[model samples]
Target chain A: MTNAQGADKPLVLVVDDYQDAREMYAEYLEFSGFRVAQAQNGAEALEKAFALLPDVILMDLSLPIIDGWEATRRLKSDERTRAIPVVALTGHAMAGQATGDQQVSCDAFVIKPCLPDALVAEVRRVLAARKASAAR
Target chain B: MPSTAPLTPPAAPGSEARTESEPLSADRERALLWRLVDAVTDPCFFTGLEGRLLIANASARQLFVADEASNAGRRRAVELNQRLLDTALASLATGGASAVRRRDLSLVDPVEGTDLLFELVSTPVQEPGCTPGVVCVLRNMTDLGRATRALGESYRRLRASEQQARSERLRLDLILDSVADPILLTDPAGGTVLMNDPAERLFAAPHDSGEATRRRARTNDAHLSSFLSHLLSPGNARRWRGELPLVEPGTGAPMPMEAVASKVLSDQGETISIVTLLHDRTEALEKARLLEQLRAASNKLEAKVHAATAELAEQNEKLRRQAFQLEQASAAKSQFLANMSHEFRTPLNAILGYTNMLLQGVSGEMTPQQRRNLQRIDSNGRHLLQVINEILDITRIEAGRMPLNAADFELPELLQEVMAEMDPIVARTKLAVHTALAPQLPPVHGDRQKVKQIVLNLLSNALKFTHEGSVQVSADSAPATSTVSISVKDTGIGIAAEHLEKIFEDFQQVDSSPTRAYGGTGLGLSICRRLATMMGGSVAVQSTPGQGSTFTLHLPRRMRQA
Candidate 1:
């Protein structure tokens, strides 16, 4: 969660209201060689994200106040935070599609508790894409 | 008559008085005769053979001439006198000349009109060598005649009164006969004194012979004996009601009757008669029998109705129990589906994640064939995961537990993205794709994820269900009402009428042929509908059986300006 965490070995923030999910995602991210930060809700995630400024955020859409949709908007709108990528986490895949359909800006949608490797790959891809944009 | 003591009768031994009274003084003889006549209460009279009045005492003159002057001019009196005189003369001419005669002797007095009496003792008197002289003596016996007349009048009145009483009895008997009901009257001793013809007929017998009547009378008397006994028990004055059986004299058959009796009394308070009335009870008995039958039938019907109601209640109870069991089973199935989805996905997440990490060389490098094989494994796994996800989505929706993440999101942006995503698929099918986004659309409060799922599912359906026709995605917003409608219209193989409703059901496809040229779990539309609802919106589809299909999503827009 510190700025020293490189873009390739980026720090990843995992936000979910479910305790099991937060643990699961943190384990998966750590195994994938990314420094992992975990929050139980959008509010916690926002506070943590400021301190961490992680490369990518994996946010559960159903989180309490400052849900994934609003959190993504806030992150995208901030100058210091605009470069970070946000991906949606959901239980029902159909519901995840609905979030994309409403144009609540997020880099991608993934159903939870998703396969660890698929989630890590998404994290690494988005981080690499952000690093490429930042180099530009 | 100084010489009366000097001479006695010449031939008389016990004739002293005769000799002493010989040549007696005329004054003395005349005095003796007068004394004898005056001594009798009856008026005395003597008559000569020539029927001339010879001698009469003062009594005779008073009685005989009592009405002679007073009744002389009356015709009835004269006739009465002549009849009296003829009867007296006729009696005297008979050889014995002794008879009792009753005659109406007239008296001319207004107070005493006539007189009648019985006369007796008339004898003839004769002298030597001289014609016999007839002498008649009269006696007044009018008082005896008056007594006889009074006795005769009393006997006649008694006979007339008896006749009137008998006739009155006959009148009552006739009245009793005219009525249909039997009637009888009993004597104070409870013996049958009078019975009407109906009563006689009811207990039938011959009526002609007096002997037979007497015999019947005895039998009736015997039956009445008990009645009298009951009445004598200080209950005679009280109205006695009872059932009695009168047997026919000849047939010996019982005639049942309901009887009511009362005691009739004379002025002296002595019971003169016991009167009874009878009513036949056959009809009443028959009516009672019929009523009993009707009551039994009604009771049977009531039992049947009760049984039918019991059966209906039992059936209803069974139906309710079945419905409750189905609901419980359905709920359990939904819970199982949700739990399985979460559990299954948890492990699958690791498999897919590890694969992705390997493919991206986050772990290490891999050969070209290994990478290609890994890609295939990932692709196929992804496809299988999509199917599993669809199954979970359909189950959750059916269980009514799908969550909605509502917020303010742009409908136009959502629509444009859907069209853009569907454009590649449309290009592959060589079909034209079109878009219409309403100008300056308002944001809507909805679950963005669910809304996007609906749009993606609908746009995919348009591309998949169509072969070569154009696909159109349209968006319109009501600025005044803050509502947005998004639609995907396609010139595709339209749904059959029967399949339109079926298409929205989980895992339901139009046909079951595996080679039917379409591949799916048939859960796309169902998921789309559920997602739309979760976003506080709805999804509807219209299709002609042979034309194309249009799917529309409606959402309530949020007032971003407000």
Candidate 2:
């Protein structure tokens, strides 16, 4: 989490294999008035999500361990992290496929080479969709 | 008298006659008879009632010759002749006067020493007052005995032959009946001369009224012809082979038969009768039927094998095509890996993001010089991103994989969006931007995103090349050609005539000097031209060095797929 972040602020977990890309996104989200935690792989991401109880997860599909899709699935299946939204951020097109007609683990898709601002916007949109669905 | 003499019977009128005229006729008759008897082949003799010799023929003398050593034989012969007379007299005493006495006699010739046989005939004479005692003769009979023996031998042979012929006939009948198939011997008129047991059963008449009802078979016209007429025909061969059907006795289904008919001919070559042999063909027909069914089943199995082989061939072809597609996909995968890695857009994204954060004072406060340097880094990173994007775009287009999103869009509206997108560059540089869109420019059918990218390329080129003059964006429709042209006019350093064509090639610029004022990868014009060509359009340029340039893109009103 960023220093000086308030308890009222929402938490976001950023997962990526690329360290610089993960840190940059975290830095921008921290600046954008959200507490941001980081993980370099999907295994670390799951650990961070469960410990921090983050409001949302930014997942990169290709990872060194436990892959984003499987990590997201495990997170969704657990009661502790079921409510948290997952946004897939990747350079590759359509890396995560939904199993038949099931609701996908990733709540949003953002093509990479994405600017920090666009990534923030997509994260906000996924969070907002979750909020609306929860309100219903 | 000689051997030919016929002196008459001892009881003849020569003994009974009393008239003198009778004696002359009788004597003359006696002489003629004696001459006839002398000409006979048999030994004839006549004896008087007194047992004296009346007459004798040559055969009698040869039978009882009186040669030098035969006087006793003559006396014995005389005694036998007189005894024959006495026997006739004795038979007359008991059997009345008309009866004759006869006996067989055997004697050996005294002269020839050969045996002889004679028949002795003795008769009583009664002509009122004729000669007394009896009249007799010894008739030579040796040749008669020889003839009788020959006749008896002939009768014995005839009887044996008849008995053998009867047995042969019976054997022939048994052989004909023993045969399984019906064998019939018939006359030319269809009259049955001989019918074996099987033939009799085959051609039996209908059961009589007192018997159980049953079918009795008769030959049809063709069968009759095959059995008789065919063999009877003079022009036909002596043998005939043909097929005929006789209805079964009870089932009435035809029992097929193979017939062989042969004509029995006489020595003169006339048809005597016909012999027909009828063979049952039921077993042969059943075998043939089974063989036919087996062949049909085998043929069906062969066809099934051929069909399975064809299906296997089709499956192999499908697998081959799948392998080829997999190879192509692998090539595409490698291409993507090389291009995406080389581009490194994520790093550029991070750099620009960090630089913007610093400029926004998120990292801390920065000096004006530091801000300026940071801005340069940001700009350079952005430029590199554009260069990478352009290279990737060209690569995709050359691979013929660039996807199009063709839709109707107003050219003036798209131009407004392009101008707005370039406002930052316009402000950064001191370039003036203006649009002179035709009042009634029609909406175009094209890939809206690609068309916008082409417009952006032209606008950015105009803005980048020009030093201080205004950049003009204009669009107009050519109604006759069904086209719309968007021209980007710039007051900038223009291309030479030789370099004009070269500028449209990939990574080509008017000037290659390192210190040139304008900076770019020089791929914008090439990309624009290719995009225009892909959309059924063209890009034309008119320029003069150090004065101005106008690059116009001509697009069709409707998209035409290549």
Candidate 3:
């Protein structure tokens, strides 16, 4: 799995509308030995998802122009992006009800304003599950 | 014999003169006396001793005659003459005057049917050398009686006219007294002649002046006095007007009076009196004051209402600005959470992914402990990712930013998927998971994904809360009302009644326990309710403190899509 660059750090995509939050998440992810890129909205997230094909996507539910719900649907629907595991990052606790069979196109759901340990834990679990499936 | 002159005929024959008497025979003397008596214009006669009319003058003859006939009879004259001669002879013998007066002597003419009024004057002529003769004069006095009667009637009529004039004056006085308006009269010479009781009282006078020479003046009778002064001024004989405020002596309330005066002219073109009419303006004054007060009050009320409206407008503007700010803040918070999650997950993904690849010996085989250490890293990384997902979900739900995708789908199939998803967890915990869908239940038309998410969340909550108990999922149809209800119940640590309502609020749980035991964002129920409401539905929980808890999702058969 190591690339030509020795000790290849995992790359992450941060999608949010606020600059402060993007910088904050970038700081945390970088310190954790990962390469990070930021998208302010869902449309940017979609664009970067294709160009970078990052290890995982951190999707924000509320975004300008195209929200996370539609962006997730498009990502899961496309053949190229469908295999990439998508997880929802939302501040609103109200997303639980909206995560129905037809609505939750992503692999998993998460809440925002979370503890750092919880945040790191969820990101690790979904990635591990993806690697296991790929090895199989 | 101052001059020896002969007096033959008089200068005028009607003016005759007589000498001293000449002696003659008795018959001649009596004839002469009768002729002299006939010269009288009154009725005269001579009667015999036995009451025969021996002689009579032309007036006496005419008196005895009936109509134009002369010498018609002597019987009636003889009776009248006998009474007159007897009265005259008796008066001469008794030494009374030689003339006797007899009135009311009734004499009937021989031919005339009625009697005539007569005055008989009898005189005895006992002259020397003349026979003893009786003279009787009779005159008609009916004309005199009528003249006296006419004079007496005129006197009585004059008295009655004076009485009528006095009574009319008294009646006029009584009428003026009974009236309320003051009334007064002045003479042509500008003297006060009459005044009524009201005039006296109005002027504060003790007595009303009668229509006479004497009159008492009142202190406040200035209007009348001024009117009379103006009329007698000889220059301005026209009408005059004056106004004054009259104060009530008892109550001290001032009354406004308007007085108008006009000259009363006589037929001779002389001004006699001036009548001044007074009108009270108290009611008119009071009405004007009340109108002013009402206008002032209306203006104040209108001003107050305008101020209140202005204040309300300002408050409404402030509330609108506040609402806009809150909306912006919420949107930014949601964006921040989403961005953080995306950025965090990517790097974490690489770590967990590389660890798994190393454990599988993708490039080289690893030792047992190394593999175990890599597995730990992978598992911990996965747990971190799970927490990240829960945090993002809760943030979206709290900010009311959760997305709901609505579409038509078979509700039973979706429920089966939910059971399939929860089966592994239930099997690991060794808890029974049971489900039932109402027969012939209408397919719910709502956010299909959101509905599934709600069912899954409710199922996970049930499984997590329970230790080794049954978790049941059931659906019921109320087709009559076009709605479906899904319920998930678990025999777990129950919620209290009070906490039941608060448990659906964002970031709130029945108890502040860590998520490791009953792993959730504490926002699951809140998000479920919000999403349900977005699809025109609602979520409610029924629980007992010790028994168990049941979460129900009631949704419409058809709803407005997001």
Candidate 4:
């Protein structure tokens, strides 16, 4: 259901290497009543994330140029996009887990081949958690 | 006073008829005496007390005469006769009561021209009142004197030889006693005829003790019997030597003795006695025994070393083979994982993602039939991805490359989470899902994600198999044993008794036929079992033919902390 957000729709940046996955994520987010922008690789994702200052970022960790891990690090470090939440999307099952000494900086993780509705639901949950923490 | 009785009346050479009563004048008497002296075989003469030759018989004159013409031509005969008359007169003067004397005289006979040995006798002669005269008689004795001298020489030589033989016997006795080795000389009958000082000491008993002597004798007797038996054997060599055991007589200790026996032969080539020399061999035998033992020990050590070396070589070969096999299996596993991730999962992700978008109405407007078809495509794609993931999980476990990310998580919470995840599938089925959780259950210590996966797989299996009956899950912790058990029970088409164990094998399904109703890659139970094992837990099943099956996962309360 595409609710009528008018001009106040929250923008979401979708990053993935595969064009079909990126297009599908963009179409689903648009139809779900959100303004969506897409990047084919992590470098473009970082550019778009900073330029758009999206409310939430959907990141595919296996991106080309700069991987999602580095892009997420850059986005979180910059004050302009630091407030935006990142939800990691990856084909690797354990990519979301903290690896070695570095914690997974993203706010959420979803395995690839995930249901569209389920990915959308996770995105909304992370945005709400971020809002709650900010209010606290 | 002068006695006129004549000792014997002289017989005249011409008169054969003058009887013993006939008296004759001095001249006739003198002539008769001269004829008598001349007729005697011995040479005889008559000398006056003044040492003058008064008369000489024809025998004496014949002994002195070389030739009748030479006698008258040489006056040397008269001088020799006068010297003989003086010696006779000296002998008569020195005469004792019988007025007779004898002496040995050597003379050269002028007639034979050789030295002569003679014994001369002088007898006193008395005339009616005239001076005394001597009658000298001379006898030949050359052969008798030579025989007497030869007899005295033989007597002296015999005495010297006898003394030499006595000393030789004494020297031989000293030599025999000086030897240290026991030597025994035995008669042919094997009696102890003679023994040296050493042998005597070897065989001697305690002196003055009769019993000791008897004991010594008995021991010696035994030794003697053995010795004789060997020596008296018919074909024994003339000289033989060997070792023999004997008991020491005084000490009664056993002794190893070496005896060398030789047959003593007489001049006639007959066996006289046996001479045996004995030496002690106790030390030598002991040395030989030690040497033999050392050789055996060294041989055993060598054999053990050889066996150990062979075993080590075999172990090294086995390790090499195992290492090679491990290398090959690891390479195959890595290649498979790479292919699954790139060649299979990537495309499968696109399929599921696109189908998900279509079902979500991201692709234009869709009719009811299009929605149903898209849902089918979405579900099927998810199913295929699950199968690929299961295969990869089992392959990683088998290759021992599946690293466990262990953490502490409550079992009840994990179970509820898994149940919530399975809600959609369970809602589609008629079977009701239930839970039996022990209160205040302890947290399980294992790989949280893998444990969650295991529980989800079990619950999914339960929902998939059950048609009408309920699926029950139970979890309990046993603090005493530090273990926890989670059970999943389903009342559906149950597995046969025989297939219970086979179900957990790779790609094995209860109904394995191509046309079988169940849809699966048949690697679910295999992955569950492998994951449980990796978490130091085990998966077991209990089932009846048409009733139900209960699959349980038992894990230690605390895993080894990494």
Candidate 5:
């Protein structure tokens, strides 16, 4: 997606292996007043996150190469993108355990097939929590 | 015939050697008789009836004369002559009127060491004018008498030995007769010398076929001869055992028999005879046949058992392989379903996401018809996603891959949470929702999220089926039972009694109509029961037709670990 709105809107980089799920989530995030960018895999996600320096990351866990957890680890380790919040999105029913057990260090874990409203509300909640922590 | 010279009186030498005092009488006939008597081999002498010594023959001179060739001979003869004459005259003094006389006498002479025995024969004769005279002849019997004693002793011994032999034969006959087996004694030429009663019965059995053929074979004696003659040859072994079939008396059946032939040998090592004993073998042969048959049957049974065991092992191995293959195939199917379940959500997310946007008015002003259609699409998409989730859950449980995130939580609080989650459905249907949970419900250890899922499904099902009547959510726990029961009662159209159990199966409903009218994949109750069971709990239902059903989720206070 192209960033057509003001820079004040929190930018969310939506990464997923499925182009449609990625586009759908990005459209809803954009409609929710956040600027949305997209990548089809974790490797593309890493490149875009570095270039865009987005305020938040919506990551789909089951990606082709460099899965969401590895990309999140890379983003957290890199000084340039270490501050970005990575919210995990995946269709795995048991990924809830990954978030609870701190397997991925994601800001929040959202099972896929959730409503657009729920997905959008999660992104805003993660962005606000990241901002609140950063301010502290 | 040996002779001594003339004997004389003891004073003959002193008398000038004239023997005229004892001359044969003046009768000529008497003299002639004396000369004949002198020529005899035996000793002859004559004595007168008047008791006088008249004359003696040449052999008689042995008693009275020594021929005067040696001094000791002459002296010994002289001494014995006088005594012999005197003794003789005394013996002739008896009364015999001169017929003829014989006597036996013994004498010990003064000149000899041993007694001499003699037989004296005398004849009295009257010769013309002389008085009657007697002439005597003497024979020495020493050798003849000794030989007679020896003959008599030998004859006595012969009689004793013959008596002993007869008794021994009698004893042997009794022994052989008393035995039960047939016994026969045969000569060296195979002739029957002796036979006992049993043998007599054996051989004397009327001439049957065996005897005829056997007797014809021998070209000699008939039934009385030995049947073991083949072994009874003169030089065959002393003891021989063999089978020789003899006929039973009168019946004439070929009886199985064993005959032992023994040879009797002489001290010179000659085969004197053969003794054969026969034994009947009817019972022994019958027993042997039975034993052979039993052995055959035993071998057959063992073979059958071995074959059956081998077959069972083969079948067991085949079944084991089939079971292993089935397990492998089932594992592959579960793996496939899990992968597909994960893949399905990506598209399901798009369906639900886009539909949420259209119904949310993010895709601007739509017609009323279009809005209504979008709501249906959104609901169906949600239903499809629920079905997928249920299938994925069941498959995971079946594969034993579902992990429980168990924790301790208040059962009443869990019930309130499930009520809140089903509020949206209860609102749309205008169904009265109520909760009747015990205030002092105990805490439970379980997977909270799956419990929520099951509780939500139960509440959802209650709201979906009940159109207007109240749906009650009630929970109660019994500390004694260590269980907690959560029941969702709905006043909807109930299930028939027969369909109560059927409804809980995977992808089953009371009927096809309810599945279509209420819109469900029919997997909800199955997934609920499986999840409950996974946490060591269960789901049960009670219902009657036209009166709504109450489905209860019974959970343990503590989850049981594998």
Candidate 6:
């Protein structure tokens, strides 16, 4: 959803299981002059991620139907949605770090109850990294 | 013809004398016969063919004493002599020329009063153209008969003894052969005098060749010589027994033997020979060796079992320690997460976030009442942050993750700063605040920030508990110790005796009832206790119901330099 300055704004996708957290993040991102889309679960997030094709995806790790880990894997595996930078939001700060023999594949990780500004900053940083790698 | 007149007429007798009418040769023969008959010790007599007694020798005259004196007066005697003469004459008649008759007779001797046994012989004497006569002789035989009887008894006893000796010898031979052990009897010269069947079989020649037989003989000779020498030696025991290793004469193989050797002694105490008894010990020795091997194996197994049991015990101890450590780590992790999650932080984040957005006019301008409500949310969010910070501090202390920032700091000055910062809280309560500091109070050592936090926590707890009385803060150097103690005392609602100890535990308060009106995260006193303990110090509380509570923070005067 966008305000009056819609066409010029960069689009952002926000996904979270908690409605209050999702609304807060989406409100903040929209207020910061960005078009935003929201999905309450990972499945809906994946559908909209492909349908909307937003510039960045803010994904909560814990979701209903499909978890953020599998959704992210699917998104990265699909050639059409592979370019979208996905930032993992989790209650566990070290969720994106490798555990045992498993390597968590994510562009960025943000701890839960994070500052809105910090989350926004992490999204921009991952988008820039994606662009740099794509340019290469 | 010249004839010898009767030199002595018939001295006694029923005999008649005849005139000398024989030839000179015949007269000489008659004279010789008369001399021979007179010299004999046996009784002898000559009688005429007509049954008259011609002549008798002296022994006969003595036998017929009654007839010697009176021939015609003793008619009974004459008759008895006549009967004897008749017997003699009858023998002459039966054998016309030469007849001999013999009889055994028992007679009682009148002189000796003893019975006499005699043999009588009658011989006929006849000459051509001469009257024939019979001569009788008596021979005694008592001594000869007694000698024969004695001799027969001796012979019978000798025969019986000989039979007994033969039987005993046979019995000894049977016993020797029946024994399984080899036995040998040797002479003093080391020659084999006798051996049992077992010994002979044991030492039998190999049946191979003369060479083998010769070899066996040599071995036996050597063994016998050794046995005899040892037995006869002066220093050797009379009976010697021991294990002997011998080479088998036949097989020429080594064999173990149990041997006993003893000297045989004669009745005169002379050494007659030596006897050696031997048993083959090959099987017994094999059995002993096997038993030793089994015992060694059993000992090794026992040692292995002991080592395994010790190793198992050590492993169990190690596992138990590791499990305990893992449980401790897990508990620490849970406490850390609980402290971090607090949940107040998450909500505060949203409350503050939304409130800031509203205040900053992110959506649009807000009404006045809305602004005030937003400000109240901001204040409460900040209060929750403080409580969250307290929780974090305690978690760090308990986790041993909090680092000390030690430096020298003035105690009075620090306390003054703490009281000044507490001015707002203190202003809200109707309680008075006081501070007491020693005149020469020393600057304490240890974590400066943590010490500041400890003082702030204590002061706040005092203010929060006391409603109508003054709260006193005091600092002094503990006597006889290298420590500084800061104490906070309040006179508000006094802690119950039971709650005094509970106040310093995490999430515990004197009055934990939600509606009882004291507001706190209940972590202040616990954090103070933990922080003090981390600084090598401790906190103590003293309280009485209806009186008030005093909490003391004791810190080391000089922190350890790292």
lDDT of 3 by residue, B1-562 (tens): 0111111111232323344585655655555565566677777766543344556676776554323333535455644544554564455446656356464555554445345556666666667786566666777665565677898899888889889889988998898888766666766566667767765555553333442211223324554566457666777847767665654433446666666667788898777676656656677778888988998999999999999888888888888888888888877877778777766765665565456445655547888898888888877887688667767767776676666666788788999898888776677897888998778877776778889989998998888888877889999988787888999999989898888889888778766766445545687787788888888889988998677999999888898643
Error of 4 at B549 (Å): 2.0
Q: How far does residue B538 in candidate 4 sit from its true spot (Å)?
A: 2.3
Candidate 6, residues B307-360, lDDT tens digits: the string is: 999999999999999989987986677566654654555666677767767787
B1-562 per-residue lDDT for model 5 (tens digits): 1122322322222223435566543454444565566677787776567634466776666565444364675456545554664566457557466566666666444355366667766777779997576677777775676688789998888888888888888888898899988787888776678888877766654455565544432332243344455665545567887676556644556667777777777898888778777777877888999998999999999999999999999999999999999988888898787678777877878888898888888879899999999899988888788788888888788878788988999878887788777777777787778999887888889899988899899888888888788999898998998999899999888898888888889888877674377777788898898899888899999987688889999999998854
* Model 3 CA deviation exceeding 4 Å by range: A1-136, B1-199, B205-242, B249-253, B262-270, B280-284, B321-404, B512-519
Kindly report which residue pairs in candidate 2 clash with one another: B3-B38, B3-B57, B3-B58, B4-B37, B4-B38, B5-B34, B5-B38, B6-B33, B6-B34
TM-score, one value per model:
0.54, 0.48, 0.57, 0.53, 0.66, 0.40
Candidate 6 matches the true fold with a TM-score of 0.40
TM-score of chain B of 4: 0.48
Evaluated against the true structure, the overall lDDT of model 4 is 0.76
What is candidate 6's CA lDDT for residue B544? Answer: 76
Best by DockQ: 5
Q: Could you give candidate 3's fraction of true interface contacts?
A: 0.05
Show the lowest summed lDDT stretch of 10 residues, model 3 chain A.
A1-10
lDDT, model 1, position B313 = 89
Q: Categorize the docking of model 2.
A: incorrect
TM-score of the second chain for every model: 0.56, 0.43, 0.63, 0.48, 0.60, 0.45
Off by over 4 Å in 6: A1-136, B1-321, B324-347, B353-372, B496-499, B510-517
lDDT of 1 by residue, B1-562 (tens): 0112111112222323556636856655655566567566665655556544455565544443333345554445444443465456665566453443333333332235654464544556677885465544555556767788888988888889888888887887789898777777777654577778877665435666455554654565456455556765654455677776555444444445677877787898777777777777666756887888888898899889888889888988888898888888998887777667776776566567667667867667999999999999887777778887888877777776666655777877776776677666666788888888868777777677777788888888788888877888888987676678888899888988778889888777787577877777888988887676665567888998657999898776742210
TM-score of 5: 0.66
Better of 4 and 5 by TM-score: 5
The 10-residue segment with the lowest total lDDT in model 6 chain B: B1-10
- Candidate 1 chain A, which ten residues in sequence have the lowest lDDT sum? A93-102
